[model samples]
Structure formats: structure tokens, C-alpha cells
Target: MREQQENAAVLRVRGLNVDYQTKKGAAKALKDIDFAIHAGERVGLVGESGCGKSTLLKTIMGVLPKNGDVTSGRIELDGVNLLEVDDETRRKARWAEVAMITQSALNALNPVRRVGDQIIEAVRAHRPIDKQEANALVHRLFEMVGVAPERARDYPHQFSGGMRQRAVIAMALALSPKMIVADEPTTALDVIVQDQIFARLRELQAENQFALILVTHDLALVAENCQRVMVMYAGTLVESGPTEEVIAAPKHPYTIGLINAVSVLGSDKQPISIPGSPPDLMEKIDGCRFAQRCPLATSICKDQMPEAVVIASPGGERMVRCHHWQQAEDFALRASNPDVWQSVSAV
Candidate 1:
């Protein structure tokens, strides 16, 4: 059963292009994004801020803002294209098939309602269950997430930050969805709380075997929690592979910068920052979006976009979107030197 679950894909995204209409023009939030997450797998999506991590999650959840549009894409969940589904069908699927745990727990919960009642409402929305059944389910979920079942009636404000996040996790798991999208679920908490929350989440994931998509800027968190990692930049997927391989030896310049920027404990090495900011999405971009900040970029990189290349790896297939990926080993050595990144000037 575990092997079969690993072979089945829970979510598959193909040729996804999302744009947000602005006064200036349409800002490309996601460009030709494609990936898949298998059942019982955990994949981490890491990138700098404004790299369309949230945009991609929102698109998957069918909660994009009014101005944001998926111009082209097929979001296949369990062999069904969610884009073609009606609003009612999608709404029914949101928490039942695929649920999202947002970054802010306070905003996700209703301020006026009791926490248990909110979770009860979520459970009853999709399943035909009476109040007693829903209440029982909520209590079980709360216990699963390490929150006391008796305190389910507390308001959101009554729970501490970590507890609120735990409640959100319980709500997400209330319907026993096949997939869970957690967008920096513990970003606001301190180290100790963060560790405790992740420990509980790992335990629950082990018991339930739901596919998890964790979105965060912290590579260390991804390294510890995820089996695979996808690196995004300027609304594009730059690199993806097994977590250990990708972190130990990155292929894309942006990914290398991200890995190098993480501060290591007890290490004398200073974190190297990427020199320039991301390109403006509103402006028309030619060639590679990262060319201006990439030290290894050449004339071709400045004139044309690089296609995604697949490389065989011991753990799994690795994908990189860089024209100079063939020379990544040499580049990786130079990238460790701060001078290489600092020499590049933003155009």
C-alpha cells in the first residue's frame, strides 16, 4: 500500500501561467510552472520573497485574488483537472481533497467564532455529519495536533501563537485530505515552538500519509522536513531534485545563492547574499530573468530563455533551468567565493 501510494501522484501542475492585472500592465506571477507531488510525499518549495510561491499555492487552492488569473495551466488533482471544474465542485474539494494551512493563523480563523465551532463547520461543510459527530472529529483532530481536546471552545485570541497554529493544523486535517499545502506555517513562532509544531506535524503526517507541500524561504527547514525541494525565482522554477542532492550541490545560480545565504550554526563562514533584487514582473523580460544577477551568464543567457534540463541522479531525476548547467560543478566552486556574486551588476 505504501509503495502504491508513493507511485500515485496526488497533484500535478503543467504549463501553469498566472498573471495579475495591474494599472501598469499584467504582472506575470507564475510562468510555465510544472511539477508533481506524489501521495505520501513531502516536497518543499523554497525561494526568495516575491518569487510566486504564494501565488502558486493560491492558484492551486482556487483562492487567487480577483485580479489574478491563471491564463493557462492544468491543475490535476487525483486525475481530475480542477481548472475545468465548476465553482461548487472546487469548493467541495478545497478542504475534502486538498486543504491549505496559511501563513497567518489569526487571519484564517474567524475572530467571533469558537475555534472548535470553526473546525466543526469545516467538517460539516463537506461531510454529511451531525453536530455531535463533527464535535467528536474536532476533538480527535485537536488531540492529534497536540492541543487539548477540552479547550476546543476557546477563541482564537485565547490561544497562544503556537497553539493557534496547532488549531489551524487540526482544521486542515479535519477532513483527512489527500494533500496539504502549508505556507510557512510556523514562520512567526520562536525556535522552540517551531520545533514542537513540526514534530507534531511529522508525527501526524506519518500516521495519515498525506502528501505535503511546504512553502518557505528557509532552506534548513526544507532540508530537515522534505524529501524533495523545488527552488523558484522570479516566478519560475529553477531547480528541483532530492533535498540532500539539491542542497549539497545546486545547479542554478539563484539556488546556489539561496543555499549559501543560509547562516550555519558554529560556522565561521559568512552567508553570501544575492547581489540584486528580482526582475520587475510588469516589465517585459527578454532572455533569462536571472541573467542580470548571474555571474556565469553569457550572451545567450541575455537573449534567450533556458529550457528545463533533466539529469539522472542517484536518488531521483534532477531538473535545472540554466543554460550553463553543464558547467555547474566549476561554477559551484566559484560561487562559494563572494567575489563571483559581487562582481555581477544589475542591469
Candidate 2:
């Protein structure tokens, strides 16, 4: 049965679970995750480290490590099951139908090759274009990414950090993909450069009308750039909704913790760190994955898994996985007080 909506989405992931083999046994990296993005939509995936954000991206890209396996569920691209397709079809789909902009531009690019050559090769790999045509396209791409067209001949080391990232963006755009999954594309860059890179990405995304999935740890960044946001914890999606609604009134305790963890610039209030570490994935979780760290956790939360319920709001409908989401607004209001989290230990 198709779990996707009747209208369909550009990309849909349903009941997806991933595991990685360890010495003891297999560790669950991702739990029954479900989400969909429509054409030209912008969505953000935000979580602390080791919350399966990268695992989800790698699974969708079909680049999971050798030890990792997709245990169950389906990943659909425009209604086609990506997980069920043959290797040949998957190979052709990558970088052509959907593309990725990696986290670190420095490591993603080859130090020895000329940036232009890399871009030209990427274009040729997907399409049978002559060298002259490829070169012209490379020049145009360089221009589009804020790099001087003539400087395409230079090696990656010669370009500044921001310029290198821009070049990577150009390479991702070369195939004119329908969707782009950017995994922390602004990491390691200065504040100014991060702003510039995202600005360019937003402009290009608007111009081309491609769906975008941005994975990051920055809640503020998501609030500013993404139309919708999904929050993950201990390999499970705790909450997701329209950006404004989620940021303003988070329903899940974990979601509320994440919002309170960041403070506005120049604000008198200090950022409140969420206490306790994430649960170990290799071990079995008896109940709610977040019960150990959540301030509002109750006996039921420690004994049974919570189901995701859709709640209606003035803005739109949102999903939250919690037993006590009805008290979310009250808890969210209390979460701002540092004393509320004093009992929990910080990492």
C-alpha cells in the first residue's frame, strides 16, 4: 500500500529504519521516520549530534557505509520507490535527478584538480556534451556561484573558503537536479560567509524552483530560511510543523528544549543547555526514547512508546510524538527558566 499522500510529494520517506552492525549487534540508527517534501518546498532537519540526521541523508543518497543497512521501509522519489530500484537505475538517479551539497567543501573537492575540470567532468558524466560546450557551461556556472568565470582554472586550495563552497554549489547545480539535499553546507565558514552562501542558495533555489532539504544543528538558521522544520532526538522524529509555529510554540518537550537552548544575540538571558546525553542506539529502548532527558517525562512515558498525533492550529496542522502534548504550551513557557533544567546534567 502507498503510504504517501494522494497528491504525492517530490520526495517521500515512509517507515524508514536503518541499522549499523557493531561488535555486539546491530545498532538502530534511524527509527520509523516519515516525511515528505513537495516541489519547490524548503524543509530543515535539525538535531543534536548523533541523532541520525546524516544517516537519513546518506540512506536517501544510497551512500551508506558498508556496515549500515536499510532494515525496512521505502524511500520514494516522485512516487518511484528508490529503495526497490536496481543499482543501475539508482546510479543514474544520483546527481542527475537529485543532488547533494556536502558539509565540508574543502574535503569534498580534490586538491589537485582544477575547479573548472571538476565541474566540466560532472556535467559530462550525466550528459554527453562536448568539451567546448562543457567549458562554456562551467564558465556560466562559475559566474552563477559568485566566482569569477576566468578563475575556474585555479585549484581548490587557491580559492578562499567561501569561494570553495560556492564552487561546490555550482557543481551540485550542473545537473539541474529537481531537489538538493544540503548537509550543513555552511559549517566552518565565518558568519558573514555563511550568510552569503545561504543567500545565494535561496536565490538560486527560488529561481529554479527546486525542493531543498537542509540538515543542520542551528535552530535559528532553520527558522530564518526553512518554510518547515522537523526536530529529531534519539533516532526518532519528535516534532515537525511550519517553521513559525514550531519555533513559536513547540509541542514536544525535546522540541521545546532545543528552542530554549539558543538565545537571541545581545539578550540578557543565557542559553539553557538541554541536560543529559542521547540514549545509546545499540541498546534496546524500553519506552519513549527521550524519557531519560525530558523534564516532563512521566511513568507512562517511561513504559510505552508515544504515537504521533496531528494537532490542529490556526496556522496549520502539526505532528508531535508525546503522551502529554496537551500541556506543551505550559511546559514550553516553563522551559525558559534555567532552574527547570537544573536537575539535568549538561554534556
Candidate 3:
């Protein structure tokens, strides 16, 4: 465990575990997850579907779905633990301090209300601002996210998918949050629109200097935008470190599998799939959560759970959980085919 004597982190999640009370049993969705994001840092949480990436975001926003529960852990924003706060305080702190931009902007938007009204409502609810000022801010925010200033008056149906996403982002900006939990902020968008949204997000973060947590299944996106990368699998963080370093040399087997799925554009190799599905969380985990899928997993891995280890690398500290991580073959060299990956310089 890393110590935080300075206590200046923008956000900190410690031993966070989420569970669902289903008929089968208490299905653990999140393991003992721990990570911290500093001001102006772009931290990407990358993993496959059903890996608890979105659930983690929902818990952070205090909007856990109907059956979700925080089994144990602490989520702190600016040194204040959100888990301990009362409902009123959580309500006040929710969008004000920690905001989240959900997956679908079109569906997320209110069908009947005008987009401008929605933005105004968000701002007014958080702070005691007058309607006139709120309206002005709404227009400014619309312009900020590259939306047409006049289009703010239109309903959600009037906007395109991209515009709807931008509007949602604009609404999330109403309070000027210190941190943003964006879960697939660019889902289902075409390449051009995705680039536009990401560019706007980067610009806003640069201007406001807020911590950003980008949760997505796309490893390529994470490699491009994030300063640091945290790879999650089966509800646990398997590896985390500088993005380039992790991309170049992943320490964990699951991370290697992720890299295998995407060949670096500059490299000359073919993309390879991991060849297996994620383990079912409903079942009891007797050993490493990834042992079932890890090609390098041995009998020991099948019987014992591995703890996170700070692997030594010239690039950076890549915290990996596989006991045999140091012995695994490097996946970096396999990404020789430009067909599977693109060069960062191209971006």
C-alpha cells in the first residue's frame, strides 16, 4: 500500500468493494480496489465488460443501482471520504464535487425538457444562482463544449448523438467539479465525433485542472489520452502505471492479453485474442481471479490468491498481481503489425 503523507490527492479510493444481493449469493462486483488521482491527471480505468468498471464509477457517484451495495471501503474526494457522508451532504457533494458523465447522452437527456432548462436546473440546484445568471452560464457552457449557443434551447431529440453527448458534458460542467467520473464518455460515436468529444474533454481539463477518471473498454483510447493506466479484471486492479510504460511493457497476464488484442500500428505483428471468457463472479474465487484465463497460470495460481506487487521497470512502477508476472514473455514485441494498432505520433 502506498502512503499519502501529503494528503493532496484529488481523489482516493481505498479497499473499495461492491456487491449485489442476488438469489445465488452476494455477487462481488468490485474487489479491494485502491487508487488515487491527483489534480489535472488523466487516469484511465481499462477493462473488459462485466469487469466492474462501470459499477466502480456508479459507486463513486453515489448513484449505485437498485441492488448495489458498498460492502466495504472508502472513497475520498479532496481528502473527504464520501462514504461517511449523510444523504444531504452526499446530495450536495454528488454533482458539486464529484460529477459523472454517463454512457448514453441521447437516452440520458430528459425527453420533454429543453436542453437549456436541464442545464439551468443542474446549476441552480447545486448553487443559489438566479435564473438569468444560470441561463448565461448555460450558453457559455454550450459554447465551451463546442455546441451551438442557440441549440441549447432545443430538446434532446433535436440534437445528434454527438451534440447530445456534448450537452451532457456541458451539464456536468455546471458546477465546475474538481473531478469527473466519465464512463465511456464517447460510446457508440463515430471516429470523428469520438475525437471531438475527447479533444473537448482534454481542453476542459487543461483549462480547469480537474482530475479525470476515464472508464472504458478500449485500451487504444486509454493509451492515447491517459497519463496513467489502471487495468481491471474480474473486479480487481491487475496492473497500473504510466500509460506508455504499461502499453509498452505490461506486467500482468491480463494486461498482456489486452495488449495482444491491439497491435501497435508502428509494429509489424497481428493482433491476438486471449481465447477465453472472463470468469463468472457469482462463483467463489479460490485462487487468482484471472487464473482461469491466464495462459501462464500454474497450479499454484489456481489454489492461491496473489497480492499486488510493485514490479520494477525502467519506465515506471507497474503494480501487478500475478505471482508469475516477472516470468511471462513480453507482449510488446508481438505488436509488430500496424494493422492492429496505430502510432501515437499519428495521433
Candidate 4:
């Protein structure tokens, strides 16, 4: 039986499409991607750097550069179309409703300005608040994200990479937004510090009851922290489901390939890698985006796209797009050694 519909979605993205036009040619940066985020849900968008992960976020935040345009789609946050709102309305609706801690938020800060001033500025921009009240709120934010409240007076250059990131997060929270989209929040940091950031972000999300959309290339961490996972390739969503089920056993060939590359997921006893690169967005593709690299590719896969198939499990439901997901799963189950499987699947 199908699960009962939960009419509790906070954000719904339907048939979303984005494109870029240059003198050379037109590029489909985002295909007909569809997904929904419920209240307080933690969803991870996992994919390679060029897989249109970041581009999709930019479109949602209403900050797409002049080069990119929404060809067609609906980004409804709290029942309003974000794309339909004008600049003036988007400005007011932005931070107070939906804020983003974009990648490299440390660099997003002005080097000379006091970090406290930045938070205060953000708060005052959206509401009628004085600097004194803003500073108090800023101090609370700093403490919440693990930065020293006293250091709020310091400039961006004075803090370490992690500290600056915490400050950036503090700034993003000045409005107490309903949802936050964090793009590669821990990128370029050392592994130890990366762990700290991930832990801290998880804690913050828990306390706020805010929906979190985590976009990153880290497959292992996504499986650990996120409630659900969405895998994308060549501008389209390839797989999506609860983290545990997808990590334990993947259905889509691309999802399997992602798991195979991650040592923690049991795809490899040691470090294994998925071979070949993804197709370029600047060029047109007639069939599956991963057909060029998929080991299970057939004439049907090469010449046409596969519709999504639902895989049910104890943890959660998974939606995969592949003509031969079941076939690939059967082969891998029989072909891989038991001992090798043990190393990859510690859970």
C-alpha cells in the first residue's frame, strides 16, 4: 500500500528548468527537476561540481546572474511563487522567509567591516531594529553557531576559516527564516574542522525546526546527516529516498556508482572510483545523461530516458530513474565477495 499523503510540504519545486545562453550556444543548466521539502526536513543534494547543484540553488534564491534564466518551473515557498515576485517584494521576502549560507560565505563578508555590523545590518534591512538590539541578537547568533560572542566586534580577516564560516551562518540567521539552503557549507576546510561544522549545523537545524537543504559533493556525510538524499547528474535528479535505504542499497545505476565510489557505503573494500566524466551541458543529449558512463547501458538506455521507479524499504521510499536498476542490484549482490562487502558496509 502507498503511504498516506502528508500535506505538510514547506517548499515544492516542480518542473524546474534553467538555461544559459552564450555566443557559442545555449546550455541547459537545469532540466525538469522536481522535489519537495517538508517542514523541518533535512534533504541533501549530492552530485559532482558541474552537475548543476549550485546553479539550481541560485535560481531558487532569486539571485541568478544575468547569464541564467528560468526557462520554466515553480519554486513555491509557503504557497507563493518565488519567480513571480518582483525585486522589491523579493527583497522583503528574502531573508525573513528564506535565507542561504552560500559557499565561501567567509569571502562574502567585507574584509574591513566588523562582523557584528554585518549581522546588525542584515537584521535592520528587514525590520525596524536599532543597532543595540541587533548587536544583542548578533551575540546570540555567534554563541549559537559556536563562535565566541566577544569576537563579534572583530573583522572578517581576524577569524580563522571556521570562525568566519560560523559568523557567516550567524548573519544568515538574523531574520529567523523558515528555511535555509546551505551550499557546500564545509567546503575547503580541513577534515577535523569539517566535522565540527557539520555537527554544529545539525544541532542548529534541530533547534530551529527549520527545513534544511544541504547541497554538497560529499556522499558519505550526506548518508550520515541528511534525512533524505537527492542525486543529480547532467541537470536532472537521478535518485531520491531516505538516507539509510539509499546508502544500504541503491537502485539507480548513478546512485550505485556514487555508493561504489564511497568506501563507507560498501561499494568498495578499499577506495574505488566511478570511471568517465559526465556530459557537458553546453551540448544537447538525446537520451540518459549517464548513458555514456553507465556500465549497464543498453540500446534503450542510450536512445531514451528511463521513467522513475519506486523502491520500497523499511527505512523510506526511494525513487530511481533507470531501466535496469533491479538487474544491476542482482548482479552486484552475487558478484561481490562477502568479506569485501563487510568492509564497505559497517552499519
Candidate 5:
């Protein structure tokens, strides 16, 4: 039996379909995506570039570009439908209810303004508080994120890369938001700094009891920081479940391929790359998007899309979008053989 949590979900996304209008008709960026994040729950979204991971985050935050539209979906926060709300209401809810830490601290911060003022501005935008109160809050936030409270007056250029990122995180936490979406929060930083940033994030999440949706290309990072994992491919979610179970025994071919591709320390087995490039979103695919690359794919897989199959596990319920998920044990064994993945293109 699947374990059901008693706590209500903090964020719920159902049947989300996002499209972008292009010169060649419309491109589907997200298709029927659904998930939920409960209070203090950490979920990771992992995929290659152009897999719609970032687009999904932007859509959830209501910051999609002009060309992008949520053709169908429901985004709810604490039972409030965000997409159904008025513009003013959604605008007001942006920082106070849901905030994001973008990929780059250099680009996200304003060059001219002091970091302190920017954070204070964010706090005052939602809260009816004076500069002094906001400033005090900013100091507390800085302390929370491990940045020196005295350095709040410094400009963005004055802080190191990691410290700058902490400042951005401080801004996101100003309103005590129930959920935070971090897109590659530790990108471009050194490995040591990356560990530090995630440590701080884990500490903050524990202290505040806020939900988190972390988007990144690093499967190792997802395994380390998130309790749940969702794997995306060509704008579709292929596998989702508890992090430990999914990482240890992947059901989908794509998920297995991803695990095989990761370089394990001191392991004798060499990393094997998944064959073939991701499908083109502009083209209409009638079958499984990964059919061309999957070693276990058959004629049926090439002719039809697979629906998600739910499997109950001790950790939680596992979801795999592959027709052959029932033979996952066999697939896992075959996927371990580097020879099975030794396509000429992979070399």
C-alpha cells in the first residue's frame, strides 16, 4: 500500500500543459504534468537542458514569457488557484507566497543598488512596514542565510559568488514564503561552495518548515538534497518516486540510462551515455519520445505513448511512464551492462 501523508500539500499542480507559439505552429513545452509538494518537503526536478524543467518552474511562478502559455492546468497553493486569481492578487502573492532563487547571483541582483535596499524593498512590497522594520528583517535574514548582517549595506559586487547567492536567498526568504523554487541555485560555483550552499538551504528549510522545488541537471545533487525525485525528458515526466528507491532501482529506461551515465567514484564500471539526442519539440511525436534511444524499446513503444504505472513501495508510491516497467528488474540488470549501451554515437 502507498503511504498517505496526513499533512495537506502546500503546492499542487494538475494536468499542466504549457505551449509556446512558434513560426512552425505551436511547440509543447510541458504535457499533463502533475505533482504536489507538502510543507517542508524537498522535491527535485532533474533533466537535460531544454527538457522544460526551467519552463515548468517559471510557469508555476506565473513568470512565463510572452510566447509561453499554460493552455491547460491548475496551480493551487493552499487550495487557492493561482491561475484563476486576478492579476493584482497573483502579483501580490509572488514574493509573499512563492519566491525563487534564480541561477545566477550576478545577473539576478541589481548592479547599482545595495543588497540591503533590494531585500528591504522586497519585504516592504508585501508587508506594510517601514524601512527600519524591513531593514531589521533583512539583517535577520542575512544572519539566517549565513551572511554577515553587517555586510547588508554592501553592493552585489562586493560579495563573493557564494555570499552573493546567500544574499539572493535572503531576499527570497524575506516574506516567510511557504514554498521556494530554486533553479540551479548552486550553478557556476565551486564544488565546496556548492556543498555549503545546499547545507545552508537544508538548515533553513528545516528551521522554517517550508516546501522546496529544486531544479538542476545534477542527479547526485538531487539524491543528496531532495527526498523525492522527478525525472523529465522531452517535456514529459518519465519517473517519479522516493529518491532512494528511484536512484537505486529505476523503472523507466530513461531513468536507468541517467543513472548509468553518472560517474560513480571508485566504481570499476565506466559511465555509459544514453543513445540519441532528445526529440524535437516542434515535431509531433505519436509514440514514446524516448523510443528511438531506448534499448528495450519495441514496435509497440515506437507506435504508442506509455501511460504512467503506479507501484506501491515501502518508501512511497513509485510512478513510471514505460510499458515495460513490470519487467523493471530485468531492465535494471540489462541497463547495468555497459555493452548494451555501447552505441557508436555514445562513443
Candidate 6:
């Protein structure tokens, strides 16, 4: 039954390429990105900073900055190509079909207006509901997110950080969107609040059955909340598969490095950092972007870009982009040694 639903994806992105125009040149922010999310499925996107995670989300929401352009790709939501739609059509689709929960709730809410009014306006903008109906919906949403309904009339300054975030969640749920893109939604909250918010979000998702795309750097959070994970490196999707399988046996060197860099509880192994920063996107490169930093990279990896190779897994098909994917077991063994990573110098 799950496989059948996976076959009919709720959202799909194919061959996406995005670039930002700068004085130096066009910086390739997203390169040939492809993925799909089924109805009610949860997928986590993990990557280091400046690896195009936010860029991908902004592109999907049609909210990219003025300089950022989607050079080529198709962002299909329920078989409708979002890139082909007009500005008004895209605006209508937002919150109604897809919504975003940004990292900064303070930036998302209006400082001067009441929180409840902001949410009501969001609902009435896309929906033809009256003020009374919208107000009722806001009250219900506040209750769902653990925010007090009576406090809806309070300004953003009056609410605590956690309360503000909950209010943002309430706004995102106003229209019960089909898909929600949460980009580090709990970045500013305490650990306890983060856990609570996630618990509430899980409950809401189970009830609403909306597809969720969680963009975060927290691999532990991903392992706990998401069923699948996608790893990005230097504007490219290097690996993606079932969360458990990918976490246990990563096929990409970059993915391996990321797992090793995190400190695990009850584990004595010291975290090994991946040496070297990511490649500069402004410059054109012929080979894999991770070659300079990857200990397993060879001459071929440095000379030619590898396409994504699909491998069968117990959970499903896993995709990895590496010329030496056949030697992943060997690479994993060698990657555990800190000397191997330290020996590589960025070219």
C-alpha cells in the first residue's frame, strides 16, 4: 500500500538548476536536483551551510530573490508545473497547496498586528471565508499548536520565542496545505520546546496527512522524525535513501563524513571533521564538487562528473553520485581514519 502511494508522488522536482547572478559570475546554487515526496511521507534534507538546501526550498515556493533564477527544471505539484504558472496562480497555490515554516518566526510575523489577525488574513487571502469563520479557524489552529486561543490578539512582542513559533505553525496550518516546507523551524527554540513542537507537528501530520519536507542540519532529528534522507554537497544531491540505511551505511563519502562529524551518545569515538571547505560555485568545474575534500576521490573523480547511480536497497532504491560507489565499503573503512582526511589538500 505504501509502495503504491510512493509511485504517485504528491510533489516532484526534476533536473532543477538554479543560479544567482553576482558581480563575479553566475554562482550555481542548485545543480540538476531531483526528488519526489509522496502523500503523507516525511523526507529530511541534510547538508552543511551554503549547500543549496534553502535555495531549493525558496525555488519550490517561488520566492527566490531577484538575482536567483531557475535556469531549468520542473517543480511539479500534483501534476501541475509550478514554474509554468503565473505570479497570481503561484500566490494562490501557496498556503492553500503548499506552505513554509521558516527558521525565524520573528521575521515571519508582523510586529504591529495581532497574531490571530495575521493568520486570519492568510486564510481569507487564499480562501473566500468570512472573518468569523477565519477567526474560528485561527482559534482551532492555536489550540492545535498548544498556543492559548485567548492570546491570539496579543502582538508579536508580547509572545515568547516558543509562542511565536507556535503561532507561525498555526498560520501554516490555517489552510491545511497539502505540503509543508519547514526550514530549521526549531533553530531558535530550546531543546525541550523543539521536541514538543516536533511532537505536535507529528500529531498534526498524522491527522492532516500532509507531505512534509524538513530542511535541517540535525541528522539525529532526521533519524528520529524522517523516514528518508537526502544529502546535499556543493549544490548537488550526492546521496538519498531510507533514513536508517543511509545512516548506517552511507554510499557517498560526503555523507560518511557528515555522519562521522556528529558526536553520538554512549559512543566513545571522537568526531572526525571533514577537511576543507566546499568548492566555490562561481567557478566552473568539470568533476565532482567534493573531489577536493573527499578522501576517496581519485583522478577520475577529479576529472569527470558522475551521474546519480541507483542501487537496490531493502527499504527501496538508493541513489548515489560517486564514481567509486562500488568501493563504498572500502571507503567507509578508510574514512574512519582521521589521517586519511587530513592528508587531502583542497585543490
Q: Write the per-residue lDDT of candidate 6 for residues 76-124, one digit (tens) a residue.
A: 9998999999999999998889999999999999999999999988887
Better of 1 and 5 by TM-score: 1
Candidate 6 wrongly placed segments (more than 4 Å) = 1-7
| lDDT of candidate 3 at residue 93, scale 0 to 100 | 86
Candidate 5 C-alpha lDDT tens digits along 151-189: 998999999999999999999998999999999999979
Model 2 misses residue 127 by how many Å? 1.7
Comparing 3 and 6 on lDDT, the stronger one: 6
lDDT of 1 by residue, 1-347 (tens): 53564349899899999999999999999998988899788999999999999999999999999999999989999889999999999999898989999889999999899999999888878878887788789889988999999899899999999999999999999989999999999999998999899888888889999999999989999988999999999999999999999988889988888988998999998999988799999977778889999998888998888999989899887899999988888888888799999888654
TM-score of model 4 (CA atoms): 0.91
RMSD of candidates 1 onward, in order? 1.9, 2.5, 5.5, 4.8, 2.3, 1.5
Q: Quote the RMSD, in angstroms, for model 3.
A: 5.5
* Candidate 4 total steric clashes: 1
TM-score of 3: 0.91
Give one digit per residue, the lDDT tens place, for model 2 in 1-347.
Answer: 13433354889899999999999999999998988887788899999999999999999999999999999999999889999999989987899988988889988799999999998888777779998898889988987888899999999999999999999999999999889999999987998989988988899989998899999999888987999899999889989989999988889999888888887898887788887789889988867898888878888988888988988767556889999999999988888887787665321
Model 6: what TM-score? 0.97
Give the worst 10-residue stretch by lDDT in candidate 6: 1-10
User: How many clashes would you count in candidate 6?
Assistant: 0
Best by the lDDT measure: 6
Q: Give the alpha carbon lDDT tens digit for every residue of 208-281 in model 4.
A: 87888899889877876799999999999989999887777777767776776666545347544656677888
Better of 2 and 4 by lDDT: 2
For lDDT, candidate 1 versus 4, the one ahead is 1
Residue 198, model 1, lDDT: 89
Q: Which tens-of-lDDT digit does each residue in 1-347 have in candidate 3?
A: 13542365888899998998888888889989988888888999998889999899989989988899998999988878999989999998888888889888876788999999998888778778887887789889999999989998899999999999999999888899998889998977997999989988999999998889999888889877898999999899999999998877778877877877776688876677765677888888878888876656778888887888976656545688888877655534443334323321211
Compute each candidate's TM-score over C-alphas: 0.97, 0.95, 0.91, 0.91, 0.95, 0.97
Q: What is residue 63's positional error in candidate 3, in angstroms? A: 1.1
